[model samples]
Target: MSQNLGLRLCLVVLLCLSGCNAFNGGSTETASITPAGVPTDDPNATRGLAPGLTNHGVVDSIALGDAHEAVLSNTSFTIHGKTTVKYSNGTLRRQGERTARVVNPRDRRYINVSIYTQNKIRSDQKSTNNSFWSNGERVLVALSSSQTNSTTYQHFESRDPQYPILKYHPQKERYYTLFQAVDTKVINHTTNNGTTLYRLTSTEIADSAQLIEYSMNVKIAQNPRNLTFHAVIDSRGVVHEYRLAYTATLTETNPSTSVRVVSTTRYTKMGSTTVDRPSWYAKANNTTPEPPTTYS
Candidate 1:
């Protein structure tokens, strides 16, 4: 696993553990939308909402491990955006951020993304990076797989933003997925670009099944517990952003260990984003397109 416990601890736990803690001021109240709407570079944009979001008409509802996906299917969703994660375990800590750009919101291929991670242990920070992008027509992967120690990158015909990358085998947080942990205190706020957005926040509770989806097909991690979360979702059901914070029990260590994690995902620069070829892509794409790899 990578030195940073955020990706390592959360993903390493896999099917092992769950939960986190945060401020719990969520109410089912619906906040009125302020008319800060002006079209951006994203053609699908309308304030914080995308196209195709439907209302369930259920307010003040806290659906823990229930009906969260009902909101996802109807969402036009953000295929181009950024995601960030942070983790800590006593003296050990980690922080990382990911930027992604998918060519089509309807397709998972021909994407551009980069992940930068750092670990803080023993008063020192060590960093590593991973990426998936195109050179010409073929795609290249700079992932350090769990089953291999090879230093060279892998080449693919196409890229999946969710495909596991980096040594810790962490997947890119897809815009289509949402954790059911948020209870939500609804409100509307404007972005720096003058785009109005909706927000919902609350403390998190352990849900191992949800955490498992975060882990890749690598070594098992600890069970997450007492997690806290918040999300930016509009009345139309578009999810603009979310943050998850929690700790999990690590049994691999003698005295069961607890690792703290904070994961934040948001959508920005939607339709305007593009995936440009990285300097290393040409070198990594030297061979024929290999079979596509399975993701978490």
Candidate 2:
């Protein structure tokens, strides 16, 4: 394949894998869960639990830890990361930091982050939603605006203009909507060493309820396949804790060989929590109980 075509194909695959919808904004919302063989809640009790843990029948909250660890063939990549999540007051606060090393590509590395609150930005920008800068250079700008007469939040941004903008709609289940995209199909699914494997693909964007949404292409051919099931958690219903099993796939183009590559990233018990923040404004105020670390 020509270098240009190869680049296009690589971009498409990346889009499908990550669901990179840069233009759409999103907010944390509640999701219902029904795991089988679990005990139903007892209405008489003031508290409840998710069946596997403690006997606190009047349970008001629960917590859990999750990790994504994987190994892959056909590519050389190493991912190291951890995430912390707390749920309460009908909201979820998640913070995480990840760093990856590419042995092939260009011998370069970058840090990726996702913090639940707007605390990641400046105070002024926090309210209206603003850009994230490094050393006075605006690397990313996020706008938190709403669609007319709708409960949904629309986030549109050029986090890195060199890459396309992203849009995320939490209310719609359209995890990511990528515009002007491209694709490459390599391994169906495979793992190496002790890591777990997960793969994702994207179909053309579909219009749902008059809103545009993209369907995610996901594959799990490893021991912890359950870990990759795009879980939407509603802690209020489950009782004491919220548990997450997340598995993500990443592919990088070999600048020299231009080979399309993949990896199986892995981990266990990456995050858990017993606290929650009501709103971004409240979190900003620092009125809530002190989390081990204060971002804003």
Output the worst ten-in-a-row residue range by lDDT, candidate 2.
64-73
- Best-performing candidate as measured by TM-score: 1
Candidate 1 local Cα displacement, residue 264, angstroms: 0.7
What is each predicted model's overall lDDT from 0 to 1? Answer: 0.41, 0.23
The RMSD (Cα, Å) of candidate 2 is 21.2
| Residues 129-216, model 1: lDDT tens digits | 4455643345576644232443456676763422433221112122222343333344334553454455445554434645534521
For model 2, how does the per-residue alpha-carbon lDDT over 217-254 read when each residue is reduced to its tens digit? 32311111112112211222211111123222212212
Model 1 lDDT, residue 149, Cα: 40
Q: Residue 34, candidate 1: how far off, in angstroms?
A: 8.7
